[model samples]
Target chain A: MTFFYISAAVALISSVLAISRSNAVHALLYAIVSLLSVALIFFMLGAPFAAALEVVIYAGAIMVLFVFVIMMISSGPGSTQQERRWMNFRLWIGPSVLSAVLIIELFAVISPPREPMSAKPVIESKQVGIALMGPYMLGVELSSLLLTAGLVGAYHLGKRKDDAAQTEDVTIHD
Target chain B: MTSVPAEYGLILAALLFAIGLAGVLARRNIIFILLSIEIMLNAAGLAFISAGSKWGQADGQVMFIFILVMAAAEVSVGLAIVLQLFHRIRTVNSDEANTMRG
Candidate 1:
């Protein structure tokens, strides 16, 4: 429970920073922290292998790309017209009401009678590797192909970083 | 008796999901939107782990690893597209990229 609370707190702070901050680099860092906290939460839930993969894959590789984008692009909200704003009351009212109802539902579940059955879980790093390459090997290969396609797509997209020169590329139909 | 109930995990995941949704709805930055999407994904993963505990199986944990791999792919592809869009349009803001929207 201590780990849970700690992860909750960190997640809250990091997520807030990740969204609210004006600086792109700062926001990316907050994203990293947010991901790591959730990874820790996974660990506390007896998913050590998943937790490590989360850190290694998400916090390590994906966030690195996010940070690289922020580095390449300055923190400015580029070419934004002054006609619109991010705030609108319609958006808040609906979600807020839903959240209130959800909170009430959560309170109802606060004190339940659970037998708290935890198994001796035999999940090791090796077991996962074997499972991936075993009969479930199809899943592993499919995902690897997906990941490779993603990398190729990313490379193709980012290779055209003519930032200032390509300003005429996006034609607004409005 | 334990200090915190086992179902606390579910509630926490719900909270994270809400936060992520809020981030998604309220933020206009593309990168922030992507990050918010990640928070939502993380919330889902946490819920799976909590459910795994309830069921006494490692399936949820295994599922989470796959989710992690997918998220990495998503982020890389997404941010790369964002980067490229910014380069072409010179803006990373999503509200302005409505050229395709009818």
Candidate 2:
């Protein structure tokens, strides 16, 4: 429980920091920390597989992708200065108040007393694998299709016009 | 061993989601907007995991995996679009991309 609270706090704080940073790289670093701490919370909640995926996919792969893009874009000091200028206190106030109202409503809705239940056994990755391959197989297949489409779309969108023209000669049959 | 109350986990998720919302609303940069959206997606995943844990079921984790898959696809395509947008405008500012408004 202690670990859960600690990590939860860490996640929240880092997430806040991640969003508020002027530098994109700095924000990505904080977001990684926030993700890692969320993984810890998942482990504490007895979803070990989810925790592992959170760390590996969320923190490692996804964040590395963001970092690579940031590096590729090479947003310089001028961009950071622009970000700082854009992130003025007046811009923050309205959203912060709105979110605060949202949080209050959420808390009110979920804070009602409920029956306490006994703790369940940990869910192993093996069961998750079986579940995925069994009942959720269709979802898995669909997601794969979605991923493939995303890959193709990203390739098309990111391709340079000249590069596409150059490759057109190679795809003359198509 | 004692487990944290399910409500606490849920509250944490709510807080994170709200923070992400604020970021999305407040930030003008397209990259930050995407990052904020990631945070919001993550908060939803956390809520699912917490609810699944409460019920002692594997379904929550399954949903999380699906969410993960979607987020991956979204990020890849989103970043690609961002890259193309940057190439065109040379600016990451969302406000400057007003050419599509009219």
Supply the TM-score for candidate 2: 0.80
All models, DockQ values? 0.40, 0.40
**Number of the predicted model whose TM-score against the real structure is largest:** 2
A1-174 per-residue lDDT for model 1 (tens digits): 544575677777677767777756556666777777776666556667887788887888777877677657664555232113323444344334433443343343243773332333535667656766775777788889988998898788777556544454643411
Candidate with top DockQ is 2
* Displacement of the residue A111 alpha carbon in candidate 1, Å: 31
lDDT tens digits, residue span A31-100, model 2: 8778877877787677889988998999888888797787678667687776576567764553354344
DockQ-based CAPRI category assigned to the predicted complex of candidate 2: acceptable
C-alpha lDDT of all candidate models, in order:
0.69, 0.81
Candidate 1 lDDT for residue A96: 46
lDDT of 2 by residue, B1-102 (tens): 367777888999999999999999999999999999999999999999989888888888999999999999999999999988777667889997776423
All candidates: TM-score:
0.74, 0.80
Candidate 1 wrongly placed segments (more than 4 Å)? A75-122, A161-174, B1-6
